[model samples]
Target: MAGFFSRSVRATADEDAGSDEAPLRPIAASDAVRRVELLDSFEAAGLGWFWATDAQGRLIYLSDNASEKLGWSDGEAIGKPLGELFIPERFDDPNKTQRPLVFLLSARNSISGLNVRLAFTKEEVWWEIAGKPQFDEKGRFTGYRGSARDVTASRESDLNAERVAQFDPLTGLANRERLTTRLTETLTSYRNSKRACALLTLDLDRFKQITDTMGQQGGDELLKQVAARLEQIVDSEGEIGHLGGGKFQIVQPDVDDRGALGELGQRLIQALSQPYSIDGARAIIGASIGVAIAPYDGLDTKELVTAADLALYAAKGGGRGQYRFYSSDLKNSVQERRRVEEDLRDAIANGQISMHYQPVVCAKTYKVQSCEALMRWDHPENGDVPPAVFIPVAEDIGIIREMGEWALNEVCRQAKQWPVELRVAVNVSPMQFAHDDFAQTVRNALTNSGLDAARLELEITENVFLGDIGRAQGMFAELKELGVNLALDDFGSGYSSLSYLRTASFDTIKIDQGFVRGATEEGNNNAAILTAIVGLADALGMETVAEGVEARDELELVTQRGATLVQGFIFARPMPNEDFVDRLANGQQTYEARGPAKYRAARKTVFRRIGLIHEDNRYKVVMRNLSKTGAMIEGLLEVPLGTQVVLDLGGGQLAVATVRRSKGALQGVEFENPLISDGAEGLCTRHRVSPYQIEAAGRPLAALPQDPYSLIMGEQEGAGSPRQFVEVEVGTPKPGTGY
Candidate 1:
């Protein structure tokens, strides 16, 4: 080894002296031998490793000590491809232009401080290597020499720092910075291709309540669980990022269709809104999503993020557990929501809220067994305000508890006037139920109303179980001791667990309307879920009520699934107190199912102005209700039946339809194709006119403007034909005719 090292040193010195003008001193053979020994000693000490590769890139020599450190036997790495021995580290940054070791070797380029991960190691090992390309006297490639050192320890620390910069410490999800960078890159890339991307900005609703009840550590744990659930939902569809606190963002590329986007958003809300167990305590939280699509809502990251934020604000304001799509009107909607929030405080304080009751009747007997009390607000200026609009505002403004207590008292008082056989159920919010004296609140309401505790049923949602489980159990026990019936409302709606049935004492399980809404449809799993829930309830000696049975097929399905009670529009719409009392006065305890005999497409009542296009002539009309299959419209005069028209439903959605039923100014139009779920609670056409298409037609790609039909028509040749139908005032009554 000493003689070989001395010869190698002399050859290297001769080669170097030849390249320079200065002459090098000749070394003594004995001194050169000693120097070789010294080099051998240094290699044995493991200070560093020397390696050489052949022209074909196969390893020719490696330090014996280094081979042992890498868990390789002596001569094991010899003749193996050097590049195959290690894999280069890949950087995720799109700006990185680093090439692999094979590329450098093939190009005969010098490598310096290049990091690569060793292959087939029990533990991750990284090596930082430097090598210079070698050449023969004829300039032909020969081999390469390199020095290598183990960088595993330092590389780990570097990776840890990078992870910290990119991910949330608590949830292990991409951090805000990463999300922003990703969104920016996605928007920039998609803009050139004219592709679509979606952004869902969400924040946990009532998260502070959980933190206040369970402390910060528990909140952190809950966030981790939430992150896990979101990952499960998103799976390869896109990326999920933690935006600090309880806020999160999801980026999905090429997902512009409202139907798919809406489905994804709803799935996120439903999954995250379910109950969570931290340690031994249960915590309930909900999420609201504001969704914005690139190229439609905005073309840049900041613009899209702002649009999504506004949509999320609207969703939270509408109700805490819903999702909303970004629209041009969302900005105004946010301001209007603030006004509603202010008015809600006064409404709760001034007793401006009222209750309406919908009966839950026996499936077999069709006799009214109980009625669920629903809260309604009749604002002096706003007229009729939907509970979905005001309830969340009340909760946010700290008026929910007061409003709930008022409703409980009012329901109990009203129940006292009903027949003794009838029971009244009042909806209980989790926030209101979490009060220290919730059981006492119930007792007081019953006492003040002079109503029997047996006749007053408190309908609590699964959300009530989210908190300290023991405390919730205690509250349930105390309420049960007061002789009031307890019903679990919206069972199996979100984060459902059989453990809830085992531990919590509930008298009934009301299947969520979501399950019952389309249970009868083919391929829908709701029927199976409904059956399982009813079986679970029956096995637990609890009754089951199926809510939202709007059609006869739904009624039949729920009844066959062994649900004991039914409640929905199929039985009757919630009636005012006077109307409810009048029915009782007339001995109308048994209500017959009077909805559509067969299942029909669900229709949403929407009274908004829309454009109706016929033969290039666009007419102003009001859409009264919209469904997947068709829509009922008014505000157009004397439209003949079977007239083909296109209804512009805004946001570039156009529904080609034929007037099926036309009488006077009102008509029912059947869509040429069915609409799909918009991902929240609405329906939309599957396809919309792309902004690119609009741009090619010389119209700017911006937020959809009012009367899209007019813009589309203006671009067509000879689109100035006079309208065929007269536009009637929306709210004005037609003379000598009832619409």
Candidate 2:
């Protein structure tokens, strides 16, 4: 080390040493001792340290102070490579722009402002180093000399500031800006390979009510709890970003399978809906998620985010606590919903809203004992709008409170004309039930109608059990005091808590239609579930009503399971109040079960155009009806049975099916694999055509472009092989008529 230090005492030292004169010391020989002292003082004061390396880039000299800092004793680091002393870290670089120390050394280039980690430190030690290559008067490579100072503290502060810029302060999750940058980069890079990614936009339900009542501090705490739960749920599969307030976004790269996405969306909804402990008080909130997959829903971050936001609007508009996948039609749904909201404000004034009744017959006798009141809206331009469609819209527009009050008063007024032996049940919205004056409103309705309180039944769903459990019990008690039967509606479907039955004095339990839908099918647990619910109700001395028994088999199963009352289409579709009154006046007491004797796979009646592919040809056909397993198509003449074909349901979904039955211009084709929900209102396949296939077919890789199938199958028409079936033009099926 000492000999190496003398190797460069003077630039011309090498030449001078061989001459007759001794070496010409650059600092005058008298000051040479003082120069060494000054350098020693710099090290002792911890201002900086000096290092020199041999021509081979091996460390020849390191100041004693620096050696001690590295826990090295007496020249232990003397022969190590200079690069070995500063290991480049994969950790955040204060400025993401720095050449590697080794690269600079190997190139014999000057290095400056380079940040590197100390290779052998117990804790991270960063250094900002600068070095210049040494050479003799002849421009030959010599090793280097450099000064280094500890920059760990300042680097940490810079990194912390960078983290602050990227993360949400309250939740410690990535902020929207960071997530947007990540999404943009992912989509841009994946465009060439056509990889799929799904983004989920979610926000808390009932969050506004919390903020209004609990204040911002309470709301912030709830948001924190939600963020923690999301971290636990998402783990490493994706990144979560806090989009401020109660909203959040998630980016899952390389994921587009609808089934998995749907499952994860549902898991998020359920987990977020669970009770949260805020400030030592229990609060309940829910989440609604909207999912958009890249290359399908949208091609870029802006398109994808807009699609996801639209889907979220649809989800919240459909009903809170649900998830919906983005579809092109959802573009119009938002505008339509806005119109619905505007029209609904005038509905009450224009008498557009009306109440109808459906009979609930005794399960054993089939005698009509109670009739549930249902709200229906008949639009002046659109005609009758189903309650399922407009009710959610009404709820979102905040008109449900007014609508509920009107319905309660009208139901009571109408019940006054009915026989006292018969009861009238009205469904109550959870939002309406949560209001402070709900019980008082009920009292006013009963008093004004002059109807016996016992004849009015209020159906309250278990969702009302969310938030303020003690308050819910108090409301239940107040309603019980009015002598109206309080039925626990949609049992076993929501907030499935036995504690509800234990705490509240409910008069009856209405078994959810979901359990009865496929209860009679072989290997289904719904039947067992129905039986268990009835037994529990019986043990609790509460009457049970089975809802939505649409078939004779469904009715028989619920009756056998000891359900006290049955309400569904098999009894009778909801009828106008005048008709209901006429039927009772004319002695129509019992409703005979008239549906199909045995349950078949439930088929949704659909009337829409779809592509039918056979051989190398595609024909347009009307899908008359669809089920998970099969679909019936029209507009094809004399289709032979046992023929395999594909149904192009759009969005890159191609279902392979075989003709199971055939009639003139109509055929029933059974799918080889059952269809899954598209995470909204439709069915879609689990897989879509890969972009790789499109690229292989002589097309550029891009987001899903329409008519990609045409490329896959070659040109559609204009020449080719002979056609098979005759294409028959079919008109739209008239309402209430079978094809």
Candidate 3:
């Protein structure tokens, strides 16, 4: 047997010795003999092999087991470089420099470990390699030692765990965590550039309803279908992520084209709107998309998501199944609505809601034919709030009826001051008309203001008929009896019928702007519908007012279709009472004669009446109803202030008239016809009755009441006693005038 120290070699470090590289004590020959014997014993253990290489590419030593592992005898491996058998790339620098094992030599030398997986002797086996520096007795550079083991089973287990974490198990795409990480990265990049991206937060509308009807598994199947569709839509231009549950997020990066985004959003909406067959049960689910654009809406991942969520809420609130852009203004609208709710409650108590006048002009003549009564809120702190923002809020709080009443009263009061030809139209909220007292309210408004019932036009939308039609009919009949003109606003857009027009007591049907705006398009469907609607209204004996006449072509088309009145930007936007008054004054100075076809061309052949008066200095008028051949005069004032007077009838049927007598507005006038036929009795009998009859009709003519002061308030609750309205004539100045 060999002694432990007999075969051991002495180690020495000729290089500078650092504390980490201290010299090792020399082993006795007996210890060396024992070390060799121990290495020989390990070689037989079959636990794999160990090899050592010097800092140079030289193999310093090898365990006896290396020969068995590599199928080579120890003598065959002793002189070769270890990397030749293991590492694919060897350090062949002239300096022999390497990392980790380079400084372990007195001469130029180095050692490096090979990092690789290998099947050295058998293709079925895998191994991991680890190498370290070895030293001699004096801590001088000697070699490096390496060891490796097969770790395929452990690594495979860890890899499976990682895959489970990073991917959606159902779709094999990035899961919520991975998607969120990508979102964070995307947001980080966007933050530096101030560029924009749109984050689409999509949730299937009616999903809960579907899920309830279908089982949870069915819902899962539907979600899988949605995911597949989303993947196809995203393609390579954008990225989409499943946000767990049924929600998903699509990020469109570096998108400058808004049209492209809109198109994409529409496509997504359509795609997600399709029905899915789940377990042979066909169920349709639509998506409500909320898009939040970066830079415009938010700067960070969280903020974008939040804005998207708010947009989603808005979409869902707006009847769902639609997409909406993230807008702070819309959010501000909501907050403003809250304030309006509070203000409306206070308004009801303190009566702060008032009415403002906006003149509606005739498109052809640019004359203020009517004025729409618009609501205005005077908040002590906020100043005047627009009706667009607060009206809906008022409707929500059930106070619009009171507000409507106030509007009617204000309109009636203001109408008394307007030119006799101009009408006052007040919009009646649906809530206002829903009550049984709506008709009574209008009657009271007329009675209180002393406004001519014919001049007060009440405007209601098609939906107003939905509330108790029988009651509405009764109220409408009562309103008709009071001589108030009733207009069904936005008419062609709803469930409009000839029977409704004939039986509902509506005097006018205001065609919706949507139809009228497109009426001029020759081949457009809207144009055809507009033509038909106008024809239908005319046939039903209801006058039509075409709204939104923005183009001359549209106005021409509507006029051709026999639209009795037209109002839009093509004419003029609404203006105040004073402005309308000024317009009328200017119109009087420069009279523009209307064409015969446009003035009063209703097929019914009712006479178009205009009162021409010559007044005295007090401006009291001797009124005359001019006929085709003659004039019937009734004098309230002895002489009308204006020296010349003209009657405008369609077909240029103007008749010049002079004041004959004035007995407190029992004025008499004689006509000098210029447009009608030459024979006086022939013209009178042909048109209708004679001048004597027309004069007799004005016999009880008292002085026309003065126009009342303009009371601009929203609908007022409770009944008010009727007040006398002092009508103010424009040509004559009246004392103690109030407005």
How well does each candidate superpose onto the true structure, as a TM-score?
0.83, 0.87, 0.40
Report the Cα RMSD per candidate. 5.9, 5.6, 26.4
lDDT of each: 0.83, 0.84, 0.59
What is the Cα root-mean-square deviation between model 3 and the actual structure?
Answer: 26.4
lDDT of 3 at 341: 75
Error of 3 at 69 (Å): 59
Off by over 4 Å in 1: 1-81, 120-122, 134-146, 273-275, 360-369, 417-422, 495-505, 519-544, 552-566, 586-593, 605-624, 632-647, 654-673, 692-739
* Candidate 1 lDDT over residue span 533-599, tens digit each: 9888889999999988888999999989999999999889998888998888889999989888777
TM-score of model 1 vs. true structure: 0.83
lDDT of 2 by residue, 428-477 (tens): 99889989999999999999998888988899876676556778899999
Q: Tens digits of per-residue lDDT for model 3 on 1-739? A: 2212223322222233457767574646776544664554454475645665665657655555545556666467677765555423233221243332222223333333333333256643334555666677898756666655445576677758976987777765567786676677776766555455778888876565456556677777778888899989888777777777778888788763444565677788778765566765556566777777665456667777888888776565454556766545445545655666776777745767666655555535655566567776777767766565466556546676777777788778877766555677889876677667777888888888888888888888655554235666787887888888888888865345555676787777788987865454456687677778778877778777887666666667777766777776555655555766676766642223233222211122122234342221112222234444334433233444333544333121234555454444344444564222211111221121121222234422111111100011113211243312122342322332110
Model 3 accuracy (lDDT, Cα): 0.59
Q: Is candidate 2 or candidate 3 better by TM-score?
A: 2
Q: Report the Cα lDDT for candidate 2.
A: 0.84
Model 2 off-target regions past 4 Å?
1-40, 50-63, 78-87, 91-124, 128-148, 521-523, 597-600, 690-706, 711-720, 735-739
